[model samples]
Target chain A: MNGSVLSARTLRNLLPALSLLVLLAAIFYLQPRAISYVGFNLMLNLAIPIAFATIAQMCVITVNDLDLSIGTYVGFVACIGATLLSGGIGALPFIKDLQASGALPATLPWIMNTPLAGVLVLLMGIGVYALLGALIHLRNLPSIVVTLGMSFVWLGLSVLVLPVPGGQAPGWIKSLMTLKTPFIPFPIIAAVVIAVAAHILIMKTSYGAVLRGAGGNPKAIERAGWSLLKVKMAMFALAGFFGMLAGLSLVGLTTSGDANIALRYTLLSIAGVILGGGEFVGGRISPIGAVIGAATLTLAGSFLSFMRIPPDWQIGAQGAILIIVLALRTLIDRAEKRR
Target chain B: MNAEPGFIRRLVAKPWLWAYVAAAAVWLVTILFTGGRGGGEVLTAAFTFATFSVIVGIGQLYVVTLGPGNVDLSIPATITLAGAVATKVMDTQDGLILVGLIVALACGVAVGCFNYALIIILRIPPIIATLSSSFLIQSTAIAYGRGIRIKPPAALADFTTAQVLGMPVLALCVIALAAVMEIVLRRTVYGRWVTAIGQNMRAARLAGVNVGRTRFTAYVMSAVFAGLCGYLLSGFSGGSSLSMGEEYLLTSIALVVIGGSSVAGGYSNVPGLWGAALFLFLVVTMLNTYGFGAGLRYLSTGLIIIAVIVAASARKATR
Candidate 1:
């Protein structure tokens, strides 16, 4: 395609994101100076994790499947990451000897002691979530029910891992998310990298085409000699991978892991995905759109908070937005079909 | 002696029999493990769960049978409004109890009507319409009450709490409601129309079922039941608290599912749901007795629902 053709296609794809950006800008303009920066940065930073989760949700919803356990997976990862990075149970039995004289673990390798342990923790988190997805597929369970069950299981695990939600991520991690050397925080950079990678993997690859085809018509794909099971498994694994990244981002921003963090993300992420123009029955998704949707939701939250709406009212607002988005999508789809 | 038993034949023929059996088994296990608590405590808890579950379950059943992807996500909101309205009305005097009930029912009916308008007139999907209505109702209730808890009148409280034959009056109310629903869903022309619509919308419309009116009536009935449940819960709890109806959202769906209603719509079982409600309460009470705590209770319930759905799916696949 020529440059003009590419540009036009890109513009068509970006309509949803652009609309959301306009909304964010409006919100920013309405806010007073003192709190505006706080609101803008807070929303931008918050969007990172939510955007990742929304992308994950979009992938599953694209396949006409719902994973209610994304929130649970996030909680599991956060708790696990916190425990691993914080070290075991205040002081390990062997570490107690070194700590007796107010000394750290001198014999341990630097990699074991540093925040780099987060990589291993992230792997574990992804593994656990993928295993859950596998179980759902193996049992041929409805993704909604299986994930709903997994949420509870993950909650139990979170409680077991971090009973009181006091475990903290390394100081460097928090700084990475909040500190801005120029105009953007490190987490946003990380999100962009992930988003670009995901976009390329989903849009540019044969696997992406096959996945989209499978989503649109799994039976047709199966009859065409494609492995539906493999497609589903891969989709779920991808969702888990994104969920783990979101969890890490959350931990980085919060500086601590709370079991309760996962509770709202499930619904919020679904809302974000839908708002981003990601079709629930599968096919097209833009990472940029997911980010925009997350940004819009975060701005809405900040706006509501600024208006001094009560906590319950915040939930009501989110619910209202979800319904409106769904309604609009249905109407749009009907119109398109009519055309 | 050669003839098969009538009851056995009937039980075998009933589609929901297996659901009832499954629920009964769970209930028995729960009672056994909990060592069959004191009669009064067990009765109160059982009655409370039964009444609450039936009210919510009936609403869900209506939505499930309404077809066109119907499911009332606004049930919790309807219940909340009903509770709030009932409490406010009952605050006047003993003479206003009947008036309170009327007001609660009316509020619920209005919500149902609004839901119908949104879905039918505005052409929104049922799920979307109900969900938005729920949010609107919740926000309105919270803003209006300012999160205040309204105390129920003495007579209303007595109505909820009082027992006949060592059982709470609520249990009898639920049973009566279930019987009425069974007759409404099974014997009436409206019931036949509902089933026909659910089975095939185009065919039903062609056959002169007045599809839109049937759907609207079903939703209205669902909301009224939800309202009644909310009013009873407020009286039972001695007051209406903000977001008190929230817990019923999942529980109602769980009850309907366990009772052999497909979430996709077109089928339901009131008796099965009643049994499931009893089973859920028993399991919850047992879990409490075993000191599993609130977190575990939530986990167990979620897992059970998933397991049931998966099992149902697997069974369907085999068939």
Candidate 2:
């Protein structure tokens, strides 16, 4: 009896992933040439930023809150990073003088030219997002409205920084992202590390338990003398950090900053989180499940592209799939609750 | 003798009065900044904003009042599809305008019914249900139109262009619609039922209200107005495109929220919504005139919404 129950639980958990694998296999069989190793790598590469954004989205949603500014934050970080790298901030003259005086390496002409610069850009993103988070928590505002508003603010800032898309990513950065080392790609490693860290943080820590308890019953949490604001702020900060990571990964992939790169990711990430078995009312999430879900979505896009579907039609198809997934999840949830 | 404060309270609680005051402020600000861009142009823009606001506002108001975490994310898709269908059908014959309107309304009703089936029969949460429906709507629209643009009929165009006492025909229509909606909401059994459901579904059900039916009806009413808005917009603009309805989705929700409606549902202030609509229009116009660009427009609008919601929350916290 115990063995059967364990098997059923395992089957329940594996259902979504199994379906994804089947779909991938069918696609591969139908289009053998298109489903090459290189194509798979490309799919994984493209899915990296989306997966990161989805993880960020998952963090907020785990608290029973939505962060509508995920896309805008990604856009802001990318544009700012690009602009800083390109000397778009009118610091070219200073950098040139410094280069001539041997104060900076002649080989590296980029502004703030180093891997350390990436850290700064990421910090800036966190700072801005944290400020917004503070406002939301301190003012006791709804996360959706506040985040949506911040998205606009971030978009505007991004436009002001880099009105058009054009920037060269550093060679090292590009190579680090694109080149596969031994058994796995760097991005996959990074994703695994981040996912594991996040999973541990949420599942194994006292803070994680508090966050879950608070989300499940806010009044109870408050009665227990916990600061809801602190928990929310931390979640928002973590989300922002992930958003920066996503933006940086996107920069590495595209080698440029396009204002619209992050737009669809916002909604898609939310869908991905839900698909990964993340509860809307806030609870535990399986990071591996989320990564698989992200892969499934990316594969679906590639499959549609392989079928020669029009761009607009592809968008429509994605939207339809999102709806269908939600409907299915809802149905399944209702059934389980009934049982 | 002791009811003086009560009378004062009633007067102060009047939402229409607040809406008018807000509208006046927006108009005053526009006039001061534009520095006389010709009264005709100002009036034209204001009329356009008012008409658009009324339609979108009505759709949002219904959803917000439906309770149970109900929100129509698919409203924009519905609007876009309705506009496309209206324009396509009306182009064959001027008389087909009526047919187009009926068809659009019917489509809206069908979509609403589908949502109801998902939410009630399938027992999906309202948020997920509406969001899914929105996706289906977008997909259907895309498959059917493939980003195609359709031109409006002459009769509909003329109707949109016509003016009454120096005001646009669309503006007059919007006012009439608002008045009718206000009356329906305040003095009808449907309105009472909606309020009850929004407050507490269990309590409403216990009191003998058909909870499912009320919720369904609310969505249908919301969708119908959304369709009407879409049709009017297409006629007024002289054409319909694939993304025509996308912009209104966020705007409608923002306006409804700014109008002081709780996201959780129950109490709704129609006048507050009108006020929010006026404020949004003014902000957009200002951004345009100042050369703030589309990016800035998006940013500022979002920021303002956040600010307003935050302020409201702060007030609640204080209370």
Candidate 3:
């Protein structure tokens, strides 16, 4: 009985990865050349940023919160990389767009040339996210409401900074995205590294347990002398850090910046978390599962097209998968309880 | 008898009062900026525009009042889909408006049913489920419309443009609906059941309320309302496109939340819904007159939503 129970736990943990492999195999069999290295590189190229964003979202969920602004926040961070850090503070034709009177002085080219400005603005955004955490905790504001509001602000700010989609990524980021390895593509390597890193930090550590416990039972954790507020701030900051990584990597990959680009990441990352077996109000999350989950969705997004179904039906099909998987999860839990 | 303080406390407690204040502020700005000349005309136009939002806002309020984190993200997409369904049903034929309306409602019910399945049977979170359904409806809408261009019927357009007593006829119809809903919410067992379920779901369930069904019907009603708006907007704007109903998602939420309906559920103010909707319309118009671009408009609207909702949050926290 002990051995069977252990195996059951192990199977539950590895389910997401196994499903992803099966999906990959099916794609390869359906399109033989899809097994090649170049094919995977092309297919999973965008998955890296998506994985990072999913991790960011997972961090927020670790504390039983949601960041509806994740997509727009990443877009804002990309604007910072593509504009402010790339050049002056107000450099993106803001003046040209202003037809009436007052304009911001454009005499700060020297200050804008350095990378520090980008770093500072990114820090400022993280700080804002931390403030949101504080406000949510103190005021009992719903994270969804706050983050939804923040999404508009971030998207609007992105447009204000850039005003258009044209911008240049810094030298380091461009090179980082293009880094080639012997047998594996850089994105695959990066995804593995991110997954391992997040797994170690979130799943295999004492602090991580404490962090997740705060989500599960905050009052009990507080009784045990843990400051829920600090944990909340740390999770949000971690989300901010990964969101910045997602934005930078996206800019490097696309080699351009558009405010509207990466808008899909919000819902995409949410689905990734759900696919990975995360829950809405619990600290129940898996980093490796999330990474695999992102990859699975990236491939599954095209499966309907493979079946000769209209591309329009693909989105509905995704919703169906989500509902089915969730139902399956519910069934699995019920069976476990019965056992 | 120091009832003055009691009255003051009561006034402060009404979440809907703030919405009226915000609307008044917007009206004051319009008067100041537009030199009081186009006040009647601008208000007439704003009223017409807000009438479209009210239809969506009422349904949104029901779903929102279902408690914390319960939102219907599928409404905008439903509107888009319903618009296409409306036009397709009409097929430029005369005297088929009722048939078109019925078809549009059927489309909404379909989407709402899907949302119900995801939330009830599957145990999916309401937000993510609705969001997923949103994308599904959006993609299907795109396919159905075949690149987002469908001309609305002329008869419907004529009705929407028709005015009664210096106000759009549609506005009066919506006000009548709100009045009816007000009565239902105040004097009916169904309304009490909804509020009780929203206030305390587990407790209500233990008390023998059908929590799932109540919430399900709310989603259904919201979709049907959005369907009505979509068909109307297709006529008002001369056509339906991929993004025709997109803006309503955020704006509808803004109206509902600002009107003092608690995001945490168990509270609603229907009159404030109309006020907040009109206020938002005027805000967009006033900003346009002030030469503020889309960025500023987005920024301000976002700030107001956060401000009003956060205040509600803060007040609830204190309680």
| DockQ metric for all predictions | 0.36, 0.49, 0.60
Candidate 1 global TM-score: 0.85
The better candidate by lDDT, 2 or 3, is 3
lDDT tens digits by residue: candidate 2, A4-108: 556555655775587568667877877876565566676568678888898888878767778878987888777765656544333234455677999877766
- Can you list the residue pairs that collide in candidate 3? none
Clashing residue pairs found in predicted model 2? A149-B302, A152-B299, A153-B299
lDDT (10s digit) by residue, model 1, range B199-309: 888999999889989999988888888888888888888888777787676677777777766655666667877777876786677777677866677668777777777
Ranking by lDDT: 3, 2, 1
Estimate, for each residue in A253-339, the C-alpha lDDT of model 3 and write its tens digit.
Answer: 887788888887888888888888777787999998889888887777656656667877766776666666666677766666667
Cα lDDT listed for each candidate: 0.72, 0.73, 0.82
The top-ranked prediction according to DockQ is 3
Query: Model 2 misses residue A72 by how many Å?
Result: 2.0
Q: Which regions of candidate 2 deviate over 4 angstroms? A: A1-9, A85-88, A91-122, A170-172, A183-194, A219-225, A307-311, A323-339, B1-11, B14-20, B34-40, B315-319
Q: Could you give candidate 1's per-residue lDDT for residues A226-303 as a string of tens digits? A: 887777777887888898878877888887887778766886777677667675564656666776677667666666
Native-structure RMSD, model 2:
4.3
